[model samples]
Target: MILLRLTWLSLLNRKATLLLILASISISVFLLLAVDMVRHQVKDSFSSTVSGTDLVVGARSGQINLLLYSVFRIGNATNNISWQSYQEISKHPKVDWSIPLSLGDSHKGYRVLGTSQTYFTHYRYGKKQNLDFAKGKPFAGLFDVVLGAEVAKALNYKLGDSIVIAHGMGNAALVEHGDKPFVVSGILKPTGTPVDRTLHVSLEAIEAIHVDWKAGTKIPGLNISAEQALGMDLKPKQITAFMLGLKSRLSVFHLQRSINNYRSEPLQAILPGLALQELWQMFSLAEKALMFVSALVALSSFIGLLALMLTSLNERRREMAILRSVGARPMHILLLLVIESSLLTCLSVLFGVALLYLSLGTLSPWIQSEWGFRLIVQPLTLWQWQLLGILMLAGSCVGVIPGIRAYKQSLIDGMAIRL
Candidate 1:
């Protein structure tokens, strides 16, 4: 108890230097915890991007490539599957539901998706959560469109507003289907997935807009008015991919095998969950790199604490001599320094935790609105608790070096000081 009191008094006497050290340690702790939290949350978000779907079927391509273009809207498909293949496979007895996706169009940098009402009814994300409307209902007409939350907010669109889609994926598309403008019929709530950046339209609408185009350009001397195109056959001939939900979980592998062996055209079927795991594996190196960098920042802060104590040791020779005259032993001085380090570490951790929660609370809504993922605020996870324990142990160990030096100096100074 006496040693602890002496340690406290000594820290108070050097409060300015101690506070600076405390701030540095606290900020380091914040960075480490924040990085860890984001890493885990991002993985969870990615895994939950599409659920309740057993298989994603597309033309033969790399598993990761198909998954990226189909689920994440990250890239273009290598080839498109025939609409006839989709019908034959989706009718399989083992398949419960399927959602067709037709890509290759964009509206102001956001990808446009051509799908059916089945998409609105069967699509899910984040724990089997269904898509819900923020304003209006699903598209009921050929020229109607539904906007994702981010697309609506970013473009300032509302129900009944007209928007033209470009022929390709680029923002500055040279060829646009301006004649067949789509009216916004619905706006979906924030879903915290790639779905938030997409524009949904009926498959027929996709076919109608391209009726007058050939080979990625307008056909010479051909002009199909929107009303005239609506009267013509608009059945889609090909689609980028389709998602399937099985009637029975046991039938997933059977259906996957059958799709892969289809006799008509080359095709590939992938389990969404397994594909996601493979995708995460590709990114594991970057995640580890980030964690290592944050850890180094924390270690550097502890080194700063060590330097502070060692530099202050020479100036405290007179104080040590006074302690010796008051019957304080060398062991007591060593223990005092260690206790001071432990206290600083604990205080800094507490401050860091407080700051982390405050930042999450303030920024979570904006993050969800802008980036399409929620930052859930919860108690420290078990891994975080273990990390704190390791930090405390490390801090105490750091103090040992300066403590030994102080112990030896106290012995040399003895009970009297010449100064």
Candidate 2:
């Protein structure tokens, strides 16, 4: 009871100082956890984009460029592997199935991926998961197009709705495929992958739309209508790249090496996961800088807590003397001070966690749309708890400096009040 009474009295005596302590802890905890959550989300987004695929084969280029262009749809390919080349590679005896990808097109900033039905079956993102239909089924015909969750919601597209593709990478409004509109056939569930920001169509549909087109021009006014193109053979002449799955999981390394050594061209096959790691290596410095900033913010907040505690130590001496006169030992005084510090740190963590949760709850949609990655917020894992626990322990040590000063002041000015 005395300890409880002492603790309350100590806090009440200097409410302003304690409030400062609370606020400092709150900010530090918030900074640390926020950095952690975002970093985790970044990695999660990368790994979830593509997984379990054996190889990504494409025209002559570095492994990094192919992954960026085909998988992430981040840039345009310098050259295309002829669809004939893709067919030949797909027919290799060791190959299981392959999905051709045609890029350099968009629908209102979202990527347009020309692939086969095998894509829906083979593509897995985030935990080896297959795409689930949020609404409607997979495309069944050539003109039937599938929308990703973000693409459908952002554009307000539904089954049977028509959307026209543009002939560029981004938000440019020129070169619209106004002549060839696609009917929305399926909408995929939100997977938080690049698929969430992509439109899926048949390779034949891609070929059909550009059949009479040449290099950003309409073939000198010999325009082809959608209906007429359908009647014409729609075999793609060239493709950006193709994703390959091997016949056996064990043969992936061997096959990737084989494709990398293909005789006809300087084609490259990359392991998707490894390519991503190499890609992220480019961001290593930035990530490290982020960590450093987070650490600095957290450290500054903790120092603010320490300063507040030290500033209040002089005023707290009298309170400590009274407690000691009334049978509370110096050790009791020490525990009280330590307890206050611990309580402040605990409240800060709780408030920080609460703030993170509340913010994520509101910001999830904006994060998914603007960043193409979902900011998944959940309970702290054991590792996070361990990190937080360490923070608390370190904080308690910082409190000792103030606690020692209070003890010495109380002993020197026994039974006397001094500011």
Best by lDDT: 1
Q: Candidate 2: which stretches are off by over 4 Å?
A: none
Clash count list over all predictions: 1, 1
Specify the highest-TM-score model's number.
2
lDDT (Cα, tens digit) per residue for candidate 1, span 1-419: 88878888999999999999999999899988999998898888888889999999999999999998999898899999999999999999998999999999999988999999999999999899999999999999999999998999988999999999998997673578899999999999988888989999999999999998887788999999998997898999999999999989998898899999999999999998899889888889998998899899999999999999899888888888888888889987788889989889999999988888998899987887656677889888999999989899999998899889989888777876544
Local distance difference test scores for all models? 0.91, 0.83
Question: After superposition on all CA atoms, how large is the RMSD of candidate 2?
Answer: 2.0
Q: Estimate each model's TM-score.
A: 0.93, 0.94
lDDT of 1 at 146: 98
State residue 16's C-alpha deviation in candidate 2, in Å: 3.2
Candidate 1 TM-score over all chains jointly: 0.93
After aligning candidate 1 to the native by TM-score, how far in Å is the CA of 141 from where it should be?
0.7
Worst 10-residue lDDT window for candidate 1 reads: 410-419
